[model samples]
Target: MTSSSIAEQVSTFNEGFTAQIGPELSAVFDAEQQALTAAGRPDDAVGVGDQLVDATLLTPEGAEVSLATVVGEGPAVLVFYRGAWCPYCNLTLKTYQEQLLPTLRDRGVGLVAISPQTPEGSELATSNGSLDFPVLSDPGNVLSRALGIVTEPTAEARAAHTQLGFDVADSNADSTGDIPFPTVLVVDGDGRVVFADVHVDYTTRTEVDEVVAALDLLP
Candidate 1:
């Protein structure tokens, strides 16, 4: 378990990455984040009181399962991430495995992480993080788009990705760069969202304490 908070971990990674990529490329990423911030949160993003929309998702093994089935008859914490290729996503998921999973399990709440990546990519995420929760693939961004949380990297970012030696589309099942804004939603057994937190910036994440606070509000 990492002792550092997600924000601190992200800051450390950002500093190292910036140093590796140099100022010019780092500026490109900075501009991209600024653009996303300027765009603001999606108006139609599903929020508290909204019912969860059912969608078919793939397990890391490639077996299809419905979102409701994954959550079963209990409340759940649904995490929407970019992909396994994202360092920030990996860090956040790993932290959840260490810090949040025990609390969620103790309360009988399910935890599922979803992304528009291939089952292979999902497998890597699960294995890399040593995650106990279900890591599902949302091929084609179907579920994420339904939640109105889809976004893609800017052209400059894509070029930066090329320079970084990998393309987001390559890891995605949809073969596209589209991804969800990093989001966390707490939904009741009946599928009504009790709490929702969406981060326009990929570097930020919903902390374990925040989820526990939301759970405390549940009936």
Candidate 2:
């Protein structure tokens, strides 16, 4: 709604969070982001021209659905996020709902969001964002792991999360901290990825404009 980039919105959130959490906890998160940056994207991570593997994903109601069915013979934008408990995830998803979904709809592209969270978490994300597109549960990161995009919070970061009375495992259906690095992929009707953007830093996200431009370039 604001037309500002997700990066700008996230910057504002980070400033406010730093003000609330103070320097100590903020440093812990900063260290985590730096570590992720140093580690870099996984060598085996899925990319453009790769064919995505189909997997059973859960709906918000706990029913099962196939990834192929979700794609529905059209180009789709797949968003991978940590969970509903993450403020950054919530903000990104809401922004996609407001900004990305309309353009995607007009282009006849499907939009789907996947997370390792349980059905309840998926429901919360959908309701919070008032999203019309499917918000799916990846359970144990089945599809994400297959894509080589899975990662978990470091022990130090996990401790910081605990200090804040939050644990990543608590929201996950697998009862583990495993989550997909914030990633977005544009796949063709045949399920081959045409474009992929992965963010090792959770504070950043794939922008709607970039995604639209990618879609525009598709053959």
Candidate 3:
């Protein structure tokens, strides 16, 4: 509660990015902001009380893991990220690992991060975050698309990313140029969404303390 929201923290980081990348590359963010106008926000999402789909994902070790099984045990925290190439995603995940994971584990809440990246990229993310929880691959972003959180990058965004030395195709398993919005959904034992934080802006994320507060409210 003493610290800033994850969005606020990342906004500070993004200022650095915007300054480093200059106006033309920064304009891609402008385009993305416009696109978010048509995109699904968390208020319209499968929110508090709506059940989640029991989707399957591939672990970094290439094993198939079921969301159903995870949530069946108790509460689950699902984090959808853009992938290892994204600095914002790494920052969010790392913060969760340091500030959120231990609390969730103590409460018997399962924490998993899902991304449309290859197993290799998942490995990079896990190592980067020093994550103790599962980092799953979404393959073609099938689950995220089903949840109405999927979006394809604009050409300008792609070019800007490439200019920054990040190749989405190299990280994503499908190479489809599509990704999920940064989202965090807390599902209870019955697989219903109790807390949903889906951000239209890629620079933002669900704060760790907020997620813990949500988990505390879980019945």
Q: Which residue segments of model 1 deviate by more than 4 Å?
A: none
How does candidate 2 fare on TM-score?
A: 0.98
| Model 2: residues with Cα > 4 Å off, grouped in runs | none
Residue range 80-177, candidate 3, lDDT tens digits: 99999888898888888888888988889999899999988999999987888889899999889878788767887888878888878878888888
TM-score of 3: 0.90
Candidate 1: residue 11 lDDT (0-100):
92
Question: Candidate 3: global Cα-lDDT?
Answer: 0.83
lDDT of each: 0.94, 0.93, 0.83
Give lDDT tens digits, candidate 2, residues 1-219: 757889999999998999998899999999999999999999999998999899999999999999999888998999999999999999999999999999999989999999999999999999988889999999899999999999999999999999999899999999999999999999988888999999998888998899999997566
- Where is model 2 poorest over a 10-residue stretch in terms of lDDT? 210-219
TM-score of each: 0.98, 0.98, 0.90
Residue pairs with backbone atoms closer than 3 Å in model 2 (clashes)? none
Which has the better lDDT: candidate 1, or candidate 3?
A: 1
